[model samples]
Target: MILTRAEELCRERGVQFTALRREVLEAVAASEPPPGAYDIAERLSRPGRRVAPVSVYRALDFLMELGLVHRIASRNAFVPCAHAHGIGENVVFLICRTCGGIDETTSPEVESGLGKTLKRAGFTPAHSILEVEGDCGACRDKARGAG
Candidate 1:
């Protein structure tokens, strides 16, 4: 679904979704945890041929521009975003410290309130993805059981 949507978006925007971009997106989607550019490059490398980090970074940049993937700055990794968000939408990434997992959700209230506040302060924001770090439900439950 994501691949199809990405392709459609690329066509609509007059952008070329190259084979390398598709492969990079596939690798990111398949990862359990988000993967870094170097990690992805290493994974895609063949026996004799090596995938360059610069190439992976370029692919990542393109995917991010199209909103097919997002960068988790804290972890220095990229994750395939399942949701198709619009402009100025607020996406919150719930990052689990214990299990190293990430879950994404959106809040209209947050967007509305933040938008109002930023407006009042005469501030214009470039990006809106928020990352909150904590232990996830399964990890918390497991820790309690162990306790």
Candidate 2:
């Protein structure tokens, strides 16, 4: 379903979703805690063929431009975005420190408040990404049970 949506968006934007880009997205979506560009390049490389880091970075750029993926700046990793919310909306990545899990969500109230603040400061943000690090619900529950 995610791939299908990506394909549709590319078609709508009159851009080709090339094979390498598809492969890159597939690798990102398959991994947990996301994967860095070098990790993706290594995974895509085989015995006879080699995928360069630059090539992977280029593919990541394309994916990110189309809102098909996101960069977790602190981790230097890339994650596939399902485009669950409106385009250009703020993305909040709930990163679980204990389990290395990530859940993506969006908030209109947050966007509204930030937009007002940015407007007052005459600052425009290209993209807003909030990464909150902590233990997720499941991890907290597990700890409680163990205790």
Candidate 3:
């Protein structure tokens, strides 16, 4: 389903979903706690086939542009969007500092509030990446147990 959505998006945008791009997207989606470009390259590499850092970076850039993936700036990693249709400007990333977990969420009220604030400031926002870092439920539970 994700691959099909990616292909559909590429067709709609008149872009080519090359093999490398597809591989990169799959790598990112399969990652447990997201993965950096170098990590993606390493994961895709095998005995006969070698994936380069530059190639992975290029693929990541393309995937990000197409909204098939998102770069978590705080962690310097890329993760697949929960919504294949693409993440909109109002998306939020909840990052767990304890275990490196990430959850993508969106709130309509937050989006409307941000839009109003931007409008008032006379700023035309191109993209909004709101990342909230904290401990996830399991991590918190572990902390409590340790305490």
Per-model TM-score on C-alpha atoms: 0.92, 0.91, 0.88
lDDT of 3 at 129: 84
Give the Cα lDDT of each candidate. 0.89, 0.88, 0.87
Ranking by TM-score: 1, 2, 3
What number of clashing residue pairs does each candidate have, in the order they appear? Answer: 0, 0, 0
lDDT of 2 by residue, 1-147 (tens): 668878988999999999999999999999886889999999999999999999999999998888889899878888889665556778888888888878788777888899899999999799777898998999999999999
Most accurate candidate by lDDT? 1
List the candidates ranked by lDDT, beginning with the highest: 1, 2, 3
RMSD of 2: 1.5
Q: Comparing 1 and 2 by TM-score, which wins?
A: 1
Instruction: Judge candidate 2 against the unseen true structure and give its global Cα lDDT, from 0 to 1.
Output: 0.88
What stretches of model 3 exceed 4 Å from their correct place? 85-88
Clashing pairs in 2: none
The superposed Cα distance between candidate 1 and the true structure at residue 95, in angstroms, equals: 0.7
Where does model 2 exceed 4 Å of error?
none
lDDT at position 94, candidate 1: 87
Candidate 3 lDDT, 70-134, residue by residue in tens: 88988898988877544455688999988898998888898899889999999998888899999
